[model samples]
Target: MTESGRKLILSYYVSIDGKSVGPTNGMRGVMESIDDEAQEDEYVRQLWEAGAFLMGRASYDAMKGFWPVAEHPSAAPMNAIPKVVFSRTLDSVEEWGASSIASGDLAEEIARLKAEPGKDLFAIAGDSFQRALIAAGVVDEYRLWVLPAAAGTGTALFPEQDGPLRLR
Candidate 1:
């Protein structure tokens, strides 16, 4: 947790082989194998539990086209939750109802957000975005949804560091 007592929860969907994207490298394609409504319901609960959501431009672009008109149970919380898109080139984030763009230093931006008084910040990001956060050591907790399939050779979540990590 940060000094503000707010936790930054980094949530992601990985393959059974620990790949950020499975053989398909697509969310809908590979995640379609999940025939469990219980898992989805739990995810919805988690989304509602967050005070704000964070993402990168790519994640925002992909979601902007879908979540705004989505029919899934998670859509409500997804659309309703305040969002922060961390990007250096995004001109506007107003397309989504409650969103703002953060185009500052990555670690500085994370620190500013973490210092804010609110519920824990939630992030569901693409591999590159997630890896950046991991590399910066800004994430307080990681929530991995291990898919029941192998990735074959998908992108890894954690970026290569100078040395091994002793994560708990």
Candidate 2:
């Protein structure tokens, strides 16, 4: 944390079919198989190099259940890295390494984090968190990875309510 606030960096792996609709459709498949562990290792290494991360409560639960016992070398460090889960129900995260429930206002905490000295902070979820950040005008940049195909139906990633998003 910094005197001003922390810097909030958000990152996610999303597909063209909006959000929840195809995020788990297995389209990307497993880039790293058990036989070829090096590929997985490299990806994990890159993630670790990313520094701190943030995720919504739902995303946090899903991740906590999956990564603690994961065999990937990066899994341990990734799980151990500093994380903040945003949720009203979770008083605190039980699965420990180095994680804390966010306090004060969402944007305020993010600002505090951004003010602190560190590598880079990353938001590691989709839809809800992204929308919140966008709505708050806190996001710095976005990288959309387009796929070859698209799903006709599923969850959409656009913001709710009536407003215009003027893109450049």
Candidate 3:
């Protein structure tokens, strides 16, 4: 659930073990197996709702390779919507349309974005980025797409911490 007036929603495609991404074969298999018209429709609908897409440097690198030229239902919104990439290293994001890099403090940047008038900020989950957000306790809502296959070893969605992190 969203709190107050705005929200930061983290979205992810996870393995059965809660790993965001794993071995190439497992990732490929999961992607292929989850194909369905209804699901695709729902996904596109969700994508269209986002006022801006948020991600980290790694995700920008990974996505800048594909989403720019992809021909699919979700491509329209993904390309048209503004994107905010949080990174200290990236200097340019001109390749991807409407994309910008957020180099300020994570908490402060998020606060500013949340204060803006727009739909929820939908995040495309990246391992390190997600871990940082989890540790910082900045993510308001989480949306996980759990796939069937599991990777023997991979990044966990929730990083190790001192106490339990509660969610509804």
Error of 2 at 45 (Å): 4.3
Compose the digit string of candidate 3's lDDT tens values, residues 44-115: 898888888988998889888788798988889999999999999988999999999899999888878888
Cα lDDT tens digits for candidate 2, 1-168: 333444444444444654433345554442121345654566566567556777778878878877887886767767878887777778889785677887567777777667777766777665677678767766654544344345444455563747765444
List the candidates' TM-scores in order. 0.90, 0.71, 0.88
Output the better candidate (1/3) by lDDT.
Answer: 1
lDDT of 2: 0.63
TM-score of 1: 0.90
Q: Rank by TM-score, highest first.
A: 1, 3, 2
- Residue ranges of candidate 1 with Cα displaced over 4 Å: 22-27, 159-168
Best model per lDDT: 1
lDDT of 2 at 104: 64
TM-score of 2: 0.71
Model 3 clashes, total count: 0
